[model samples]
Target: MAATGTARTAVDSVMAQLSALEDPKMRAVNERHGDDYGVNLSRLRAVAKELKTQHTLSVQLWQSGDTAARLLALLICRPKSFEQDELDAMLRESRSPKVQDWLVNYVVKKSPHAEELRLRWLSDPDPVAASAGWALTSERVSKSPEGVDLSELLDAIEVDMRDAPDRLQWAMNTCLAQIGIAHPEFRNRAIGIGERLEVLKDYPTPPNCTSPYAPIWIAEIVRRQAGE
Candidate 1:
């Protein structure tokens, strides 16, 4: 009972703090991405820094079902401590795109069980879970492409990217770009796959930001790497 009380008190305090930090404009932007939060990411990181790593408190915060709180939980949580099933459940519960992305990148990516979960999530019927899996795949493709079959990935992307749901499409696109950027042998082929599919080609991009269009994105990144 004492532990429960302490956890409850900590959760309430943090939730109240998050509520106080809400920004209307940030909330509007987040809402457009299927999330609802106003606490700026930098401010959120500051909050996490103060709390430090508290795995139990992070679990409690995660159970609260608030997007900002969940983000905070991820920041403070011990990444390697979670069981694979627990991470799976968390991803399933993550309806907010921001939460899902952060959970996969910040926590799951650092876990020891990353590969196991990545393989399972890749074949998951749920697109969101599959997207997280693809995000992991992209990480491996760029950093550790030893066992990754680049050609097979391209074949899959060529067939599926155009019809994939928003989240999965974005992840696959990242993988495609990673292949092109990291592997000289596959650069042309990756660009070819991207061009043929034309995914995100027409997507509006803000001024000065690189477009997500793969062929252009690949060439620009490769150019910058060679001191263009």
Candidate 2:
């Protein structure tokens, strides 16, 4: 509704047409491209040039069941120029929790408003949010210029560790071990958590291991932490 005015009519028309399309595959593919979406790569540039505003009617074309469309929307959606309310609105409508986490994770890295998004996400009811929180914590501790306190993040993560999905738990613990080995400052902290998880005692997660990353993930962390 608050979309830019100059392109209103054209965008509305496009939104209407795209929304009506029933072809799942084309919608999915086009959604990924966003403004750049076109049968030809050149058409993307032309379309983007024609549609200068951030929010457009054509984006609704993403409502189809096409996974590509949903993914593309996430790829093209930008929070830099968006107001806080707008960002919140976009996350709410996204429907895809992964995309929401992707948006949150993306903004936290580049936007000055990272803290706001982080706090909101940390408190989110979604398990993906908690899992994303762990991932974000790992990234911040590993890469943040300001340097994060691992103890604080670990404490928060451990709060709901029992409830996270197995895959998320595996990733969360694996990330912790990686940080421990890479950041000596947090080595003790990482080792403490990793050893306690006893990841190596169990089988590795399937694909990555005989079973899951849990076994080896936990074991490796404990071993490295103990200086073995």
Best by lDDT: 1
Q: Provide the lowest-lDDT 10-residue window in model 2.
A: 35-44
Please tell me which predicted candidate would have the highest TM-score against the true structure: 1
Q: Model 1: which residue pairs collide? A: none
lDDT of 2 by residue, 12-109 (tens): 55545434543566546656644222233233334445544344432543444333344344345454655655555555666454455556665545
- The sequence of per-residue lDDT tens digits that candidate 1 reaches over residues 1-228 is 998898899999999999999999989988987898899999999999999999999999999899999999999999999999999999998899989989999999999999999899986889999999899999999988888888998888888889999889999999999999999999999999988999999999999888899998999999999998
